[model samples]
Target: MKLPGIKGFDEEALKKYFKNTGMLLIGKVGSLAIKMLSSIAVANYLLSYGNGILTTSVSYVFLFAALAGLGLDQFIVKELHQYPEKREQILGTAFSLKSFAGLICIPLIYVAWLIYPLEGIKYSHIFLLSFMGIFQSFTIIDSYFQSEVKSKYIMQVQIIGNLVSAAIKVGLILMHSSITFFFIAYLFDTILLSAGYIITYNRKGRSIFNWKYDFSLAKKLLTLSWPLIISGIMVSIYMRVDQIMLKQILGDKGIKEAGAYNTVVMFSEALNFVPIAIVSSLFPAILNARRDDKVRYQKRLQNLYDLMVWLSLSFAIFITIASPIIYKLYKPEYISAAPVLSVHVWGSTFVFLGVASGQYLIAENFGHLSFIRTGLGAIINIVLNILLIPTMGMMGTAIATVSAYFASAFFILFIPKLRQQGIMMLKSLFLVTAFQKIFKR
Candidate 1:
């Protein structure tokens, strides 16, 4: 049962397939540019300490959001593809579960606030941000759209929401609003995005709440999602712990410095949309290939890996060279962040590879293994931060991040099957380039 437009089965069709993929990439890049501009405005207006508080609060919210939804986003996406006819049911189950969890999270957040009283206004921001999880759960419907490769609508929604948010933030800053306005802007942006998704789904005559509750579906989703929950939590730890630890180790001043560094750090992260958008577009194709033909499945995976490596490497080099200039352009306060960004941006290359590999694991239903690997990396990150941050400060955090990413990428390549896959990836690199030359001729 071949999918409607898979090209590997027909070598002559490869050019068309690649062309379409390039188009998708262009759209994704456009959307990412808008997002990057929005982020820059927020960063510039907030400065370092203000941005640190905002960053820390958002990180904490993400941690709780990952836990509250229990990884249902991934679970629903994977399961829905298997039963496209039951897209509504799958989304309904995911939506119901996530909504309940979101409700439950409110109380839990209050309790967490009590436990960590120092969070103060940060706690309120995290609680407000939790809606992003509930809003994210609505993405089950978007997954349905993605499974069919209808990405334009979702892309447009994202671009519009971001533009609106950016406009509001800029307006607020020009009016000399408080830092708290930034959080309010974020909340408003998410609400508008969620509404857009919901309205789109409704117009398509689909509802995430259409199916009745099914205990069996709930159990299955939980079984699949629990490991993801652990993995997501650990990923949060690795990604956020540096900031949290910086706060603890460096106090308020350190937090501000870390935040300044992160401003530069996130500019590198802007390149992340390329790999992410590609992976998202490619997953269903990969899954379908896996189901239909193992040889082609492996071949496609190899091609994907090769492309990822090239893209990641190019971006890393460009950012490394451009970091100092970028930091100066942003503000003089961020000049100290140039060295930190150079080291940290290189980590993005490895992190992109790790993300690509993790997608393979997810497509293969090996989420638990993915979790274990990331968990190990997270542990390494925590230990390094503790030992290095006090003595080396922000530079230490940058070093630890790159080190952790390298360790994780290394571990992924060590899996027996992945080792063989890695070799295929290398071979595919030569073949893809050779084929491109032939096509040009």
Candidate 2:
């Protein structure tokens, strides 16, 4: 039997499915546009060096935040699907565990600061930024909204919070505030955003906290999350190691250069959020399809690959062409970022493909594949950085990042089937394009 929502098995139903999917894409794009504009403002106000400090600080925060949650986000998303009746218990245990985990992270944050104190800041910024991890732990609630596919709530929360945060940061800069003010604004943003999510949950007639802990469930969560924890660490390393390496090798000045390059590179990341949101919604649907019909499972996976490639290529081309104009509009000093953007935007194609494949693996309860793929990318990134950064500088990092992503993407395609799956994807694309042309004519 076919799954209830799988493909619709007819043109009209399929059209409706695609339309809904497009709506999700449009919502995500709208939110990302707001974020991108705000980011450009921040980049303009903050010089390359200042932007570097901001990016590096956030990277460290993300690393710690991931550690603080101990991979519970992924665990919750995965296991929650299996135990709908235990929703309250599962959410409560995860929340309580994360809160306790956040407390433990306090001392750990201090030690980390002592070990690696960033330049030009007192301990205050460090202290404030430390709360970022704790604040992020509340994101566990996000999975609940996601599972239900009520993405409008998540989008509303993110858009409002981001706008408010951007306004605060921009106002601070206009007032000639110190960099410390920027950091403070960021912390305040997270705190307020977390509160907003909690309030929203409460207003929906759902209690924000059950405050009950189940030791057995917690252990199961931890066991499932272990691989994700490793994957998280690997992802963190790959994402931030370039800046960290630049800082170590070339000092503050080097970081400034790398930061400028990364500003442009990361602009493409806004595009990534759309695909992530789509995949998040589709995951449960795909999982259900896989369980119901084997042939539909293969067809759905193939369709996903086809859709990803089309989207990835279009974005890659647009960004590659627009890089120069985008840099010019941002600021004159940021022109140097164009080449980096060109190289980095192409990386998005690889990233999108890899993520689509990774979702399939996750739906199959093959989370370990995610660990392996990301781990390989991380390893390749580090090795390339060590080898290339001294000689080529920021360009080296850009090259390394692109190379790592491409390797990971190809690995996903290859390890599944050496040649057959590759041919299948190409054939699907060809058929899609030919059909489009025929309809137009």
Candidate 3:
């Protein structure tokens, strides 16, 4: 099937990428539907208070889990493309680094908890989920498939994983398991996915056992990825800290409030997979354009920005309109999330743009700037959450989130090297680029 033309991009490359991206999107769309239904069911069963506990535990681990990832996936894909013969070494080094970091993250999570514990969340819940960082080491297998442009395999794994995960949640609901079992189910999801990655890799005639760690390569990767590590932490902070803060600031009813907020996020953030699928599937093409043609590279980047803007804007508009009806799927207490969803859904337009620009940053080797932008956003989000939540409640948190997303995604406007790219995004965001493309055709 022919994709509608993007005009300036190489037609052949666009077709190839569209096919690859289409596969990922197909898989993600299926998984998104399954996960959303199961997630709402889980939320309805757990109610606001229990979900508050779940959200806090997951968010807390996610902060430290940033350290566990060490920001190696992008570099891993780049390395594998440039040096396919070194695939084993690259995978091995990354897995070793991530596994070690994941181990350290456990203790770090404990220390952070001790210093400033989540008010009503249990250590057991956090402790169980902390292993997710370690299990995530297996995701290096995912980087391998992405480098090969074999997202179909990754998609298969995601669909199967989500299906099984949804089934487990359904089982828990039927058996009327305690909140603790849900925590186990969460951890099991990571474990199951990791196992899936390994099996898929082996089926593709690749053996995880053949991967070899090299200290020198590990050092090189760390040198390149450290900024991203810090940036990942910062990204996590801005993206997730609000829910954490929500529970803390609201006093006696904080957990219930966080629970209601989680419902809104579940609906809003589910669509994030769209950007990830598009960006990941096209990244190698973007990198090739950078190596081969500067003008084409710029045009492709702009086209990507254009696509991100329109797709996210359309979804946000739909969700904003339908949020009230969407919340009808949830328990009555979650009714407040309907309005918050309307506001919070718009943040995704920036998020989509951010995902696309983030790849541009990696391609341009402007890694340090990534953390700087994210750090600024994190600080803004935290301050806004503090100032707004008390008076504005969940609505304040939504405003803060959308504001932070826009600021971080667009802050490159002030950087000399990044200014042009920022302008391209602005044109896309405002539909100037889209209009120009249409008129030119």
Q: Could you say which candidate leads in TM-score?
A: 3
lDDT of 3 by residue, 336-355 (tens): 88999999999999999999
Q: Which ten residues in a row have the lowest lDDT in candidate 2?
A: 1-10
How do the candidates rank by lDDT, highest first? 3, 1, 2
Q: What lDDT does model 3 reach?
A: 0.89
Residue lDDT tens for model 2, 1-441 = 322113323465355344545556666676677767767777778878787777677766566665677777756766677777788888888888777777777778789878987664457766778877677767877877665556567667777777787778778878987778788887898897798788777777888665467899989888777777777777777877777677667786776876686676567665776556656666665677788987877776676666666777778889889888888767777787788778777777777767777676666666776677778989999899889888887878888988888776666555654344455455543556335434665
Per-model TM-score versus the true fold: 0.88, 0.88, 0.97
Off by over 4 Å in 2: 1-27, 116-123, 412-441
Cα deviation of 264, candidate 1, in Å: 2.3
Q: lDDT of each model, Cα atoms only?
A: 0.72, 0.71, 0.89
Model 1 spans with C-alpha error above 4 angstroms: 1-27, 117-122, 208-211, 422-441
Give the alpha carbon lDDT tens digit for every residue of 17-117 in model 1. 44445555665677677766767777788887788888777766666776766777756766766787877667777778887887777777678767764
Cα error, candidate 3, residue 323 (Å): 0.5
Name every residue pair that clashes in candidate 3.
none
Pairwise lDDT winner, candidates 2 and 3: 3
